[model samples]
Target chain A: MLFEVTADPLHPQPLIDHVRKDESGAVAVFLGVVRDNSRGRRVLHLEYDAYPEMATSVMRGIAEDAMERWPLTDVAIQHRTGRLEIGETSLLIAVSSPHRAEAFAACHHLVDRFKESVPIWKKEVWEGGEVWIEGEPVERS
Target chain B: MKARVRLFARLADLAGTRETEVELGEGLSAADAFRLLCQRFPELADHSDSVMYAVNAEYVNSDHSLRDGDELALIPPVSGGDRAV
Candidate 1:
């Protein structure tokens, strides 16, 4: 499937292969990686969770929306759940189209919408403690 | 009537369980189900106003109607990470 929520670590090459085709002239990929720091704290790792059923459905919707908005040949979105250490790939978004502009726009739209709509969450494990990220109150840090 | 409820992230931590079976009366709205959940797990009351509701995996508002056997979820503000997954 092009849209997924996997506990396994994500590899971008396969998604790139999935979207690559003869008619497509441009391919855009966006990878979200786990960094070592957040808000000045040293992040040890990240733990991701999802309401899987909803997360997959929402991700597909986002991909379809991108396709409708752009002249895209294919869209693939994959997200990782469970724990990921520093530098690991947490998200992969690939879009391919006959032109660079459409591929690039769709790839950007998919990632932005996924973050806003998908039911996935991540918690940053810092040196001493862990806190949920995004949309949560600053007090949580 | 009855409903199955799912909690995630901070809501699940506060409720102490990821899933629960709730008893509800007929014609009650999603709001009523959330209110009853808060009673069962008082820790969730503080977020009653902030948390969103989902029915059968679809996002819904508090006014949405509830039915027997429906799967409901309590969604905290999503934490989709920023700059550092």
Candidate 2:
């Protein structure tokens, strides 16, 4: 139950440690890194924006749903906002279960649902232009 | 009544600001408030189909009624987590 949305850089180790349990025989983790290229653009940076209050609340809900849908022993999710450098981790998803199948499925499920509904956004800046990845067309101000 | 409208992403860029205050008639729905926004920022109307409504940080239906002093967020098509392409 360690869901959060923050503006600080994210690390996977602490989140992985949070979900580890002696009873759990398996652990699954996913990291969404800020890659350097997108849609044929050259290497650059990215900016993530989120409605922090609602984003965290929605993340918690997604984690709860993942727990209910799978035999998960623990769940944790974190998303970073604001400026992010290349190779930085923007998202960390971890889940623990008694078996590998459940852990894997739940971790994947969290990522899918979190992406589909979370009130967060990714802005891709590469070369001479930038765009809000999924929102609108490219136009620099 | 007055309701504060919050914009994000492209909508914010179109509006030239992230938030604004709008006057709403009694019993008017959040969707109606958006219509008012369109009157001020017609460019936003271009995205009417993809917009989503959030009241006080919680997702709600467009038809959801608004009250005085409510905070309504106009969520554009959220750039989902996947940036790999």
Candidate 3:
């Protein structure tokens, strides 16, 4: 498993390649990109920041949870921090399994859980001002 | 006991510093420490309801107990792109 929180744009292809193996017949990748609009506002860009230690720990927990829930051969999650422009890749998730169904399921679950759990925050810089969005604390099962 | 309190994003900007060492009475709960912090930084009082607390890198409620040398992070609102799923 590989997990990272950095300012660099995430390249999903490398992550997909790394998880591909002879025993693994399927790989699923998910990419999250920065959009130009949010809540009716024209967003110029986004600035992401995180409590690194907490974010990483939460991510690791998410990965562990994914592993337990699915028969995944490998998993990689990368979330970008700092300034990001529209169309820039913000996050990437890759999961590999012996079959396509499991790989897709695990990859989707991993990304959803990560978003709901991770401590990384995004600041939407609109044409007029900016707003900070935080995740609601959900009970971890 | 002395605990380190770290602020992130908007909270850090409001506090004007990233981290501070706070000395609390014995057996301080997360709530108590937060109240003391709010007293020191009045601006935080306005957003206390929205702020979230993390103890030792894990999100916790105000009722959570504090330990000596614990790392406390005050998380303000997150302003990132759509959550990846």
Candidate 4:
């Protein structure tokens, strides 16, 4: 129940704390950090944007799907937007379950779903130029 | 009917603005509206084959009919990077 899309910084503590349950024994966390380089470009900074409402709704759907597939105690996710520097946390996901295996698998699934389908965007600004990381041909197809 | 078109990322950059108002015929689908948008902006034709259409925050197909006041967003391939949580 921790689905969110925000411009503020992200922390796993709240999400981890959220899934703490008496019955849950494992809490798996997936942290997405802004790296210094992408596709060989020395990224100076990154800008993230999202259709907040839609993004959060999609996050909820992803969590729901994970819950249905795994014996999850709970799942939470948050994606940060706006300017982010190298090494900053950009996405955080926490999944708690009865055991370690389910927690890990669910956490991985949630991240993949968000990265592939959410209506969020990333703009990588390097020294000379910047471009949106749309994962396809940059020029007109 | 009229709809609010929202652009994002490279699409927004190519259109030279993020949001614009579009007027369309009664029975035109989202695909038709998209064609019209590219007619006005021209640059958006670059993504014609790949654009994903969303109306009112829910993804829909090209043949989906549009309505007044609907918010139509054209999504490119979402490649949200590994950034802040």
How well is each residue in A4-85 modelled by candidate 1, as lDDT tens digits? 8899989999999999989999999999988888778888999987898998888888788788888889988888898999
Q: Write the per-residue lDDT of candidate 4 for residues B46-85, one digit (tens) a residue.
A: 8988788889998888889998889999888787746233
lDDT per residue as tens, model 3, A1-141: 887888887888889988888889999988889888877788899888888777778778888888898888888888899999999988888889999999988887877777766777888898778877766645523
DockQ per model, Cα = 0.44, 0.43, 0.51, 0.52
The CAPRI classification for model 1 reads as acceptable
The residue-by-residue lDDT of candidate 2 on B9-77, one tens digit each, is 778888999989988887999889999999999999988778888899988888999999899998876
Clashes of each: 0, 0, 7, 8
Show model 3 residue runs off by greater than 4 Å: A139-141, B77-81
Pull out the clashing pairs in model 2. Answer: none
Q: Please state what fraction of the native interface contacts candidate 3 reproduces.
A: 0.46
Question: What RMSD value applies to candidate 4?
Answer: 3.2
Least accurate 10 contiguous residues by lDDT in model 2 chain B: B76-85
Which residues of candidate 2, in runs, are more than 4 Å off? A135-141, B83-85
User: What would the TM-score be for candidate 1 when compared with the true structure?
Assistant: 0.93
Candidate number with the higher lDDT (1 or 4): 4
> Native-contact fraction for each model?
0.38, 0.44, 0.46, 0.58
Interface RMSD of each: 5.7, 7.1, 3.1, 4.9
Return the TM-scores of chain A for each candidate in numbered order: 0.93, 0.92, 0.93, 0.94
